[model samples]
Target: MIKNFLNKLPKKQVKSAESRDGGSLALSSNASTTSRINSASGARSGNVNSLENNSTQNSGVNHGNKLHDPLRSKANGSSPPVPYEALPGFRDVPSAEKQNLFIRKLSMCCVVFDFTDPTKHLNEKDVKRQTLVELVDYVSSANGKFSDVVLQEIVRVVSTNLFRTLSTQPRENKVLEGLDVEEEEPLMDPAWPHLQIVYEFLLRFVTSPETDAKLAKRYVDHSFILRLLDLFDSEDPREREYLKTVLHRIYGKFMVHRPFIRKTINNIFYRFIFETEKHNGIAELLEILGSIINGFALPLKEEHKLFLVRALIPLHKPKCIPMYHQQLTYSITQFVEKDCKLADTVIRGLLKYWPITNSSKEVMFLGELEEVLEATQPPEFQRCMVPLFRQIGRCMSSSHFQVG
Candidate 1:
């Protein structure tokens, strides 16, 4: 029976069941770092020198006019001056103008990057770097005359590729000739802006009061998050940290500042938790779920409360759990307190639909529920509790005889 039950179970479901029902566990938000684990990890390559060189080359060229631009590279004179010499957008620019544009735009993104990162506590010795200070000036004024499109492109390019790669580079390595018998494992990377700052900017832009649907469509794509998830699963510690940090912030933003984002987050998590069936990832996922609860449980909207309540149903099955029920019990306890009215409604509704609980297991499960509630009741309700205890006692007496 045990083997058969395990066979039908998916990891996320099992974890949800185990944790939601009463399983004792403290899930971590950090991605699993075991090097041997088959989780997400990888990176894309873009050479800094090549990009810089291309930018440098574009700065110095100035085409006179599109119709008769003499500065245009002469297509092999042999071939009737090829109609289009250079590509459309790369026509021409003043060297000084281009350099100023690059620096000005690059500097502005520095502000965007800072804005995205949450302000961290700094020590007395922590000096504010000059570059950081300079960034503030650029972003503040560079876009005054420029279009939002121009500002966005600048933010996208400069922010996306930079600082992401450093997350995964291994620090300590064996000195091949040292001939030491033992090797030391390196410390885990510090989590911060592991993902590109563009993600934060895109999210901010999307939620802005003046958000333009057309413009937002161009930059903010949910698919990017899927790729991030894939990278996180690659067993690369750096990628893991990056993905974790990004998701954490995204989740925080949704729960705190953007309640509208809850739908999107729930959709993303559902895909991972249900559609993907990647059960081994349950522990970390539970942490994410816990964070969601911590942030939104208080003063939850009725609609949201119902949504959360329904979401927990899939987690109640025995098939999802392999052992203890402490995690599930604790989570339910939190939900009960946060959404007492809704929880009561749910428990009453469940009792109504519960197909005749004649089995010993059902009786015991109901009995445990009663016991938990009774234990948590206040002394002031001690008199009222007597009736509840009496009713439960009657149910147990009858249930015991039927089971026997």
Candidate 2:
């Protein structure tokens, strides 16, 4: 019966179900350090040299009429306020002029517009959307490599658009027990039509072989990462899905950012578990973490173990566990698979957070517990067997027949 019920549980759309990894994470290097890298790899690409001195300092942009923000360039105070005509296509410009055109278009895109109210900035908004599509294609097929200035402009444009204050989400009506989003209608970001293009451009920019990580790191620095992390709380799932992929790629490529990224994610999880207990991207984040854990090199680090004990296990305490438990359990199983010695610690942690009042969560917990026990070693089992069965005894007598 437990097997039947567990088998019937809905599976989430986990993109990183397996480890699809590239090179080991590489830490970002400073100027002299980058010079050494340049020399070491015979200076990997022109981009490394192009972006040595770039810095990632972004003062927050001023918001205007939800659809758009104040433009960063001289265009902001222009008498008319909006640009007279759309920037010419990148392809239309001479090769020498394309770079400047790219920067100008980026500056134009920096100003976000209120798409919900199409009555405002109708022409300007259409221009930016077309420009974003052009930028995506341009980044996709740009020849040699991005220059330092170009790299900085790309990050600046991406930051300007993607990292706005998300709309106020509806309050979660905490269910004593259940598995569902609190909101009946998912709150779609009104600007997503434009925001989606920006996200795509960023994704392509990161994944582009031309956008060398060595130089890109200067702009895609820790500050950029924090801003990206904040967007995980976005009410829009589509937005979160794009964020998940971009972050995973960033983590994989920029080795230096891994510890910072993981630690920050832990902090987010801690806040979600302890303070807020609400986040749309928890499952998506766990999906990325699951991939990351799967690719863990042997002799798993103590940091990994601590993450399991601190963030991953206590995650069970949230009423929203069902929202993210599939990814959570997958992540936990990765830890155990990597180091069976952690099985005892995991079993004990599961028992510690075992649902006493929420039978639905209890069922979810039991389902995950079964997965953990399947991989538990005999010696580890002996270590926690007594308390484990003791909890099982309580669960057997659970007033909820299904949980029993």
Candidate 3:
């Protein structure tokens, strides 16, 4: 009978009740909290409990209004943006309603402000900042699975904030002939305040127990991974650090994406080696690759061997090797360690790129060769030792004291 009466609530009467009595919505929210409290306490016999139950029973009209808000909004999505003061937060909202509230927050954040001009939307900017913090905390402590809609909302909001075209590099960042990176100031992102929080939220969400890989795969797919890889070029080291960790996490958890990640990174290397010769995150990428190369199975697959020969070895030819030489040396050494037989191939590759004209590069190559030789067994050493000793003789004859 109660169900029949609720089914019979005419839309006009429901709207009229909510329109004339503004307190009904707040009453409904408070009544929900009170009923939850009373039921959890097991207070079944008291008049207070009876009164709470009656109150819950009377809020049906207000509940209908909550249900009606969605339909009305859909009827007019072209409505101007919600005022900054009217934006909702997840705090104190019922757990069951948090998902909807989360969507609203994401929608509001989708409107990217011109962070370059601080004079714009001061209050609104702070509101979004606070909203992002709440979101980060909510994702961190969330106990249940994220709904599909929530996952899409996350990607949309993140894409809006993270995937913009970064400004051009300062002249200080260019590859000057003699200036060290320490001589110049670093280019930091102006919007890092909000960017950092969003990055944190994404990192936690990716690693969260509630994020099922199967569902997450839908939004965090190949195109998503590609765009993320592009972020490795960001001039801001802090943002690239976040990208490095997040991409590493994605590569680890999303098993289906593994092969593609390797291939795409190889493409990045190919471009860096052959085309652009300029990228900010080469060291970070190689850092991630060091961990990955460590995990490669023994008697390695031909594909892995090809990567070592084609990409890792050629990484030595870049003018910027000094920038990433440590990581490059580690990755190359990992390849040789997995199969000592590759030491000969690696030694020959190193010798092929040895710099006679550039004394500093000759010194770096000598250091890398020392580390590689430490892992080289007798058999592989014999294969390349003849030319290797020849290079040592050449280095000893060099006019540069360091090479000698």
Candidate 4:
């Protein structure tokens, strides 16, 4: 099974530039060694038979001239086609030799994004983009059961400065270069598609069943979680959509990190509210927190209750209430559902932050007040009824309603 799976790997077709000493390294067969790697990968997933049966012809390295070296052309000031070495057909090359080449090529592909200098590293954006696409494709084709070494390398690259730089906020200058200067500069800029691929790679890493345990134990840490939360403020709606799923997956898989994730989000919310920081993905983050709130254990802790009172409740006071209204309402309702005694507190908090100038918001408060009233038990409802009706009376008498 190991030999067969290795033979199915796409061999590197690119020829190395000739050395000054003029000696080419000979490719050798190491069937015995690769069989060991295949065995280990198979043992890790316990599904080698499935991998062999699903192998297809389209899996080979036939990405055209995309594999050419970018630096060579940059130095010469003229585009030249660099010939790539074609892999021998499955029948022509021994399985062992193909396996050895496959392992070596995979290693190089994983290390391509490890450059320390941003200028030099991003210059080869095309190569890095293609390599990432190929890696994603290979892993997907294998049903997300790649070798641990390959997975580790991919995690390392995504965690590097290069990937972070590409995934950060895109500059207009970079976008214009992709548009006017060089058509080949698509991935060189912080284009949404390129960032989407990086995010998709991360989504795959966290969600893949084969890598779930390792990802939870290793990649999902405090610093990584904070980075993800920071990315939640991205202005690109598409990027934020992808980030929403990635973050939810992190929250779902790393159960131990749940408290910390919630705390970090609380800090972000506090900044957005009290400190007046702008965050584009606030609605998305609130949506995730709503789900987390739904799962809170009964007789909730003081900190959790405080999060609802301080963070979740005041969140409604933001000018962009409609953006997160649904999520915030759900979270607030979940708290009331957890304990009826808290209903009065929630009602009082809503009245405290009730909008004064916005008639539409006054109307929204009525709707929310109606929901909170429905959730309150008879005693709690009676207890809070006076203040609620007083606030209602104020809304009816407001000058904005008189005009309407």
Which ten-residue region of model 1 has the weakest summed lDDT? Answer: 121-130
Output the worst ten-in-a-row residue range by lDDT, candidate 2: 51-60
Q: Give the better candidate number (1 or 4) by TM-score.
A: 4
- Cα lDDT listed for each candidate: 0.35, 0.70, 0.68, 0.55
lDDT of 2 by residue, 77-189 (tens): 22234343677877687899988898888776776554444344555555566677678777867888999999988988887777767777564745543455454445655
Q: Give one digit per residue, the lDDT tens place, for model 4 in 257-347.
A: 7678778999999998887635667877877666666566666778878988889888876676665676678778878987788998999
lDDT string, candidate 3, 139-177, tens digits: 867889988989988888787767767677533334454
RMSD to native, candidate 3: 18.4
Q: Can you tell me which runs of candidate 1 are displaced by over 4 Å?
A: 1-151, 154-218, 221-238, 251-261, 268-276, 279-282, 297-299, 316-332, 342-404
Each candidate: RMSD to true structure? 18.2, 13.0, 18.4, 16.3
Which model, 3 or 4, shows the larger lDDT?
3
Per residue, candidate 1 scores C-alpha lDDT tens digits across 92-210 of 55543643554443432232112121233111001112222223233322332434565455435433422233324433323232122134432332222222223323333333334
Report lDDT (Cα) of residue 189, candidate 2: 59
TM-score of 4: 0.64
Q: After superposition, how far is residue 174 of candidate 3 from its true place, in Å?
A: 5.1
What candidate 3 gets wrong by more than 4 Å, as runs, is 1-82, 170-182
Better of 1 and 4 by lDDT: 4
